[model samples]
Target chain A: MRETESAAEARPYHHGDLRRALIDAARRILETKGPAALSLRAVAREAGVSPAAPYHHFKDKGELLDAVADEGWRILNEAMKAAGENAPSPRAAMPSLGVAYVCFAREHPALYRVMYKRSRDKEALPEHLHEGEDSAYCRTRDTLIAAGADPSDPVGLELATIAAWCAAHGLAEIGGFQQFAHLKEALGGEEAFFRGVFEHMGVFARGLND
Target chain B: MRETESAAEARPYHHGDLRRALIDAARRILETKGPAALSLRAVAREAGVSPAAPYHHFKDKGELLDAVADEGWRILNEAMKAAGENAPSPRAAMPSLGVAYVCFAREHPALYRVMYKRSRDKEALPEHLHEGEDSAYCRTRDTLIAAGADPSDPVGLELATIAAWCAAHGLAEIGGFQQFAHLKEALGGEEAFFRGVFEHMGVFARGLND
Candidate 1:
């Protein structure tokens, strides 16, 4: 009886707000406990909502995870764009973007894993995520094309993009391992270690041109 | 009363065999059901053994996982060595080794994930896995030296090795993703996709020398 007409009108707005809150809660859980611990119920609990509340926003855990991964990609896309835009020249952007990609993974290891984890499950990702033109993958491809890569030859462009991406991804994945601690020390520090790898990117990009 | 001295004598051998079986069972589970499905009890059940049996071989789940990851590295080491040895020349070995690294991951996705997953855990990997001289990481280092990288300059050699590793690892991780399906199709097929990536390795290596 206390719930009046104004409260009813505000219900849809609350629903939208709850969806964002649930995604934020899921991200926190993913960062703290890793992907295995991320469940819709757990997210609801983290967000201080009832167990059934998350279902109104997400159909199941998969949908929630996909949302979290989408958020990760959006943040990553921004980081890569910033790195490219701040660089002095188009060719210089490649190594900056490479460094940024690895640095993003280092900063958000759990989120990085979740972003890539969707690829393992066959049906989880939406069609737009898979499309080359609209994805962060395209950012790398476009950067490569801008940086002296032959835009006309799609095959060559793809190969160059793959090589650059592989190098960045590999470095990011291994950067956090204790086994590589010595490499970091030997190279002076973490920044130096990253710089050394980026130097090789310059060599690699020049080689692509040749 | 029926358990006598002879049965006691047989117990040690059974322990050793069970340990091997548990590792094998864990590998099978990892490959089929993915790493999340891997648990000591699950592995024991998969191997047709008692629930308590795995505890006799591994202290806990972490110990069991480390053992499985160790076995994965052993297999990967052999694959890499075989690839390096089969190449006609020292310089020719780099791209071959790169291809082998990615192919090993492709062939054993779950095990590859486990092998890399150990790097994330702070204390799980054995000391031997960290030894620079004995690891598969060293194989890349050695190949770089063979391909005319200055072995005396450890920093430079390490950087080159990282570059090669990052490229290979990136390709392997994304190779299975549907996002790259169009790229693969454009390259003609899966084999051609791998071949294109390997060809870029040759260019990257040559650039390193210059």
Candidate 2:
């Protein structure tokens, strides 16, 4: 970034709003054109700012994308939180949150793809996503605990959290298949289809014949 | 296709072996150079075959990618089938298949991504993938029935199958999360980590405090 330090000093002011505007520009581009067309220069152009403006807020396109994905995760975390709060009971929060997650993905397909695909090559999910209280993963864990998973059993707890997260993630990806269209219609609609998947999110534990 | 009808006819012979070779070449390319580097011409070059020879089998890169994805799905289905068969009991096959699904994704991350991303623009999972006797999705349905989900209850059966599929899919996507590194180490090795996630694939029916 120091390579452009003279340009940065020319601005001589904080860019709190510029940072937000640049992210918004990247998102609009993601929605309209897709990820391939997104670049720092494009984002700057979209925000109606000078060519070097985006660099002031983000070192490069990767950093800018990370910010966009951070925004996406925040939105998802909020939705999951709301789902947990709105459920009829602590137990019900499990599937409600799952439903919320799938809905979030369906609503923001581009953002959803970016959020997950952001770290496709990274050794792990971006730390900010799973770390801290704002994390959507943490919300899942909280709901799992409220739903009776033992907090003391770290292995079981993490496994269960991964289970819930995966179920929701899987449905979000493949639940829209034509094979499931009839089932979705029979279940009443999109949300019902989500519920159907989640209600049975667990194995049939009893395995009737057993 | 008529545009190249004469060219295709120029080689009036069965390409059974050539088709297989082309697909093999594609796999090698995918593994070595990643998806962006995969093209029909590249496959031909890799196979040490003439560029036009690939044309006899694949009209374009998209068509070849579909074939590649088909191979991927077939491998996945077979793995799931093997897992189901190897499990001690039909009831155990449910999670066994889930474990197999994730294992397949882990082993073939590039193929796995191609398999799903192939239909990112389409209305559904590829028709052949979900349609025939060999489909991985069908395998999931069969495992659900074997585990005692009611065949008569179409909604319930499909829901169960979807839940299992999504859980596996989800884990395959996020299961390696660095957040779970310690948990994976504690659980044993990677396969054990897969099992831990699968073992708790279902929701906690009892809600301990209940």
Candidate 3:
């Protein structure tokens, strides 16, 4: 009886850090299988806890999904910030951000989908979502400014940033290997793809100077 | 009993023309309700038939979705072609095509999602789907050539076309109200949003000439 109880306690819900463990497990499953495969019971099982343990942290699936989405946004914001900090100049930094954006999308495809796909509104959105989005956008906008773009008339900068993001996000959303094939044949490669997108951003930026 | 039986008998397995009926019903539901609500049963019900009726015409939900996505491409191609047919020049035709592209997205958001969602495979895409996309691209490419763009350069043409589509599709995907807001702020209204997208298209084309 004592040995059986010990075995059961090894997977207990009230273990020292079950909540965070559950979130980590959920993220791992989402990254591997995609959002459609994510389930509370499955997550609990993977975390080596009882089936009912997840409810202690998340009221429902949406809450769990929202938490994941919020975390994705935070990761994105951090990546954008790091890209900005590491670039030598604005022009150099701008394309690096594009690369970072694509890398983030590819490396965390499921999380990216969870962040954007049928995203919850502000009311339902976890607390960190808006700040994360704003941080990412501000990083781009400020990098454009640092590159000699006018802070006063920022529309062109916004358009350029948006365009670069669109192209990178577009290519990445299509996936890596296939995107490499399609883009490399025509545009030279992933680097060239970013160059074209960044070049377009330049053109859009120059339009503002005019 | 006799009348009810006759009515039931009238709704045959072949559906008197199920393929066309499914397409039409799909379009109707897409326009009236939205894309998320779409289902084979809903489509069958809309056509006044049983759930099994759609299975005869389509293998599964994806097949039905693929059919609708194909239809969306065709409709978009037709709108683009019609917009380009009688413009003052290819330059003028380009913006018209851009406008029409946005219009299609706005009028059919669900179909728009079905068309652009990341999961769909280009290689496995149904024949009509590729045909419709090719036709749409040809219209833009032809317009670019007519507008003094180099005809020999496929690479430049594709880049310009992608940029154009991205602008239109992005505007459309963001929703109609935002389109109107963007237009009002930048172009003076949604009408101007169309102009801004094409004006940028022209900008990209001229970059080639330079």
- Predicted model with the maximum lDDT: 2
Clash number for each model: 0, 3, 1
lDDT tens per residue, model 3, A27-118: 99997877767888888888887788778888877677777777887898888778877877655776677678777886787787777663
TM-score of 3: 0.78
Which pairs clash inside model 3?
B183-B189
Write the candidate numbers in order of decreasing TM-score.
Answer: 1, 2, 3
Give, for candidate 2 chain A, the lowest lDDT window spanning 10 residues.
Answer: A201-210
- A72-181 per-residue lDDT for model 1 (tens digits): 88887788879888988876776677778888998888888887777566522345543665466677778776765668877776776667667778788876766567
> Which of 1 and 3 is the better model by lDDT?
1
How far residue A19's Cα lies from its native spot in candidate 2, in Å, is 4.3
**Model 2's CAPRI class?**
acceptable
Q: Give the RMSD in angstroms, all C-alphas superposed, for model 2.
A: 6.6
DockQ comparisons of all candidates to the true complex: 0.35, 0.43, 0.23
Between the candidate structures 2 and 3, which one is better when assessed by DockQ? 2
Top-DockQ structure, candidate number: 2
Ranking by lDDT: 2, 1, 3
Can you write out model 3's per-residue Cα lDDT over B92-171, one digit (the tens) per residue?
Answer: 66667767888887666778777765233342223342344358766665665665555686665555554454556545
